[model samples]
Target: MLALYLLAGIAVCLYVYVLSLDGPESYYCRYDNQTHYNLARHFLDTSDWSALHTGSGAVADEAQTGYYPAAWHLLVALVASATGIDMPIVMNALNAMLSGVTYPLSSFVLMHALFPARRDALFFGAFTSVGFACLPWVLLLKGQLLANLLSFSLTPAAIALVIAYVHAGARRHWKGLALCSALSVGFFGVAHPNGLFTVLVFLAPFVIHRIADAITQSTWIGSRNPLRKPWVVWILGLAFAYLVWQAMLYAPPLQQVVLFNNTGNLNLSWAESAYAAAIISLYPEQPPQWALTLACAAGFVALVRQRRFWLGLPALYMLVVYGLCRCSDAPYTLRTFLAGFWYSDPYRVLCCAELFLIPIAALGLATIAAYAHRKIDRLSWKGSLALVAGVFALVNFFPFYQEPPEDQSSEVSGSHFVPTVGTAVGYMHYLMESGYDEGEEQVYSAEEQRFVRKVLEMIPGGALVINQPHDGSAFAYGLDGLNTYFRHIDTEGTTEQSRTIRDHLSDIATDSTVREAVRNSGAQYVLLLDQGLPYDEGRWLIQTGEDYEMGWEGLANLTDDTPGFETILADGDMRLYKITAEESAEDQ
Candidate 1:
């Protein structure tokens, strides 16, 4: 029966993921995902595990895996290798399955930890898997927070061990529980260190409390504390072995990432930090609209009524993270030092907060129904709760469901693609208002894709290319797995690295600085898109042209006016150029 439920949940999540990819009406290419895909493709073709990225047509240790965790990339490569599926489809499929499988797995762990009755566990597990509130779907669709998804899915399992350890103490079977906890931490750390750290921030206190309680009990009861168990000797032995293994095998890569990613600058003011913290507290981005807010509040009340205080840990967890995020703003460096490695990224924190929030909010509704059943015997509370949850999901969320008409504002603007489901005149109208149809987007054309491929084919192998104009140009390098000015997009370090490269190119025509920068960065070629390509603050608009850009201002002129560049290819909207050796010479 659980297997059946798991399958159903997986099917629903996979369907939603497809919609997210197909119906965005915007480009769905994530820089990191595509880069990793390119890396994975290269990894399989060469059977080289030494490097996670290609440099000069071969795997190079300078791969970004040294910075970004390689576990997910490796997982993708393994799946692609085993299934013989195309890279993109494998990514979408595996990631969708990750979302799907996490739903059931999380529910099972949480329900078992919190509830006693098997039926209650199953029902709440299913509900948590498919939330009544649509927040998780919102996060999942963005589709870049794969590590957060994986970590939080393991969260319930980790917490379950905490509960078991606290209750079971030094029992023989509890040894298994400790082993499970260790494995959970190991996997969580490998999945994403930030996520593992996030989970630890929540769980560590509980673990300490459990140990303290056991020690207190031990004083009277002659060492009942699990820490005193003989198995602890084995645990220590195993931990030492693991540490030695890490020191021998994993230390260099981890050290490389930590050193590379140290972008030391403080930006958050106290007021700014507090405000950002408060906003993500209720929803990952902002407070959920009033209706969803009410649903969350009901769950809040239910948890409090039941004395399920463990659930409040997520709230506190977010608070600490947000505080640490801005700790760099504080004086004496002590706070920042102690806070060590808080990524200070509002959007990243928002993603993590949402993963922790949505499932608990779903369980919150279940708690309310269970509470209600005890109060009034007239209706089937469970049935009613499920029906309400189901209707809310299908109506408001199925595919970018609309916010309440009154709740609509700047936050729910075009970027969100939220429909107007609440304002529907009647039942049939609501049905008609389900959401946007799939494949209704106007993204880059197939001809544009083919054009990109043809250019890749024509460009000399092992020649590094600098994509001009900096708007969505990373796509080309990420697509082909070629070394370029930039590669990954998920990190601040990578962003700054890419920016520095582009800054040099910005001076290509008049300044030898661009040439020096290109040569210094080990790149040889630069691709210029036709001018007239539109840039709206941060994104590039796909446009058609005859040597005309997609409205990009700098692109077309740079190709024509830029000296010290040798044109290699001119096809439609794209042109390729090689930086001359004199271009690399320092200006006198």
Candidate 2:
């Protein structure tokens, strides 16, 4: 069964990846993950263990280390460094590896915690994988999200530890269990900066329960009656105080690294919010929504009656939190903190709830299959599960077998995740052989390729290059150059570059002002998008993929003939401009 879990996990990951490879394109993910990949590449190249770039920069430098979560990238870099494997390959395996770890742990939790007599670990593993096979967030955003998925995967492990400790049946083991919980939480704190926050938030009910247990047994140090007495309140009071102290110590430093995009209020109806939460559907394009809704409902009801439901409480809590944020009339501070903490996007509630959803929905499948097992004579429950898994595989993925969606635009409007296999193969071959030039518009043209390489060739080592609306392209594949004047800055803007550049460059308030600002920032060259825009802008999954007017300004003014701009190269639709006073005066 353990071996089956391993194989099933790897097989499912490989199945999608191999299919993804069927249509070869320069980018594994059409839109996102470039920033994360480049960031990992930087860590590998620099051997620097401190600070990560929220956006690209020419003179990429580390800021306060503890403020930002670098542990996730560090793990990716370490594996790539040790094995000398490509980042793409590592990324390909990133979620899969974590998810693989997750399946077994989840199964163990389900088995020991829920269905020990079912002899169904294998079913649990396979069913769970298939149950989430069509997840939009996992598939649609693929490489874009690192910490969310990692933390979500760790959910099973965290819950498993808590459940195990509770059931450990030894008083002495409680100390070890406490230590384990601390270690688990500490790792989450490093893995995702807000990870411990999620764990603490989710584990509140359990914590209160444990307090009650201690009080009932007269073991609580301060509490004689945890339930009815004020002692429990005192315990909570101390916890809050400690949290406040930790926040003061940690938050300011994190402020140095984290930037929150303005996540405003979302006034969704209760039904709409609950529906989205039930489906865990952040990106509607990735999979059919009704499927998830149906499955999640089944699992929710099935788990509600079992001991495992308690285990899912944290996940359930996150879902409730998401619902609260969706309420327009919801308290400002509470919604703002929860919603803002989640990329300032309300739909990210789905991400926080992902781990919780996985086990719940999977158990829904097992519940149905168990019913079949008892009722059906010829087909075993495992067989029914396998059949169900096979059906889900086809239903979820069958859409992509047809023509792939063109670029990111089609991905949003259409019903599929990526372009057709044929599309990828042809594009890759064309770029490798000829490079994009003339009318051959694909994701990127070869001229821009040469232009970017030339920029790298000319720029001094460690020098920053500015690309407005910094698509992970320049840094993802560019010549040993990074740092951005405009574009692709991660939220929670804290870096010196992000703050400085964002003010002047965020909006091209004045072309001349931006030009002078670029020159003043010590930037020698800028990759101006004479033509080209991302398939999606400011738009991402939580909005159900909504495009917004671009936040990067000054593109309309980036004419080669404009002041402070000398055309170094014009490749395909993109133009490279040199930033110098002499050129600006000439252009003016």
TM-score of each candidate? 0.64, 0.66
lDDT of 2 by residue, 62-132 (tens): 34233345566777778878997766566556655665556445444534544445544335545454345
Top-scoring candidate (lDDT)? 2
Of the candidates shown, which would achieve the greatest TM-score relative to the real structure? 2
Clashes per prediction?
A: 9, 20
Q: What RMSD, rounded to one decimal, does every model reach?
A: 9.1, 8.2
Error of 1 at 522 (Å): 9.8
Q: For each candidate, what is the lDDT?
A: 0.49, 0.52
Candidate 1's residue-wise lDDT over 432-547, tens digit each? 22322223221223334455566678767766676542344445543444444543322233433344454445456566554555556676776654333444322333321233
> Candidate 2 versus the native: TM-score?
0.66
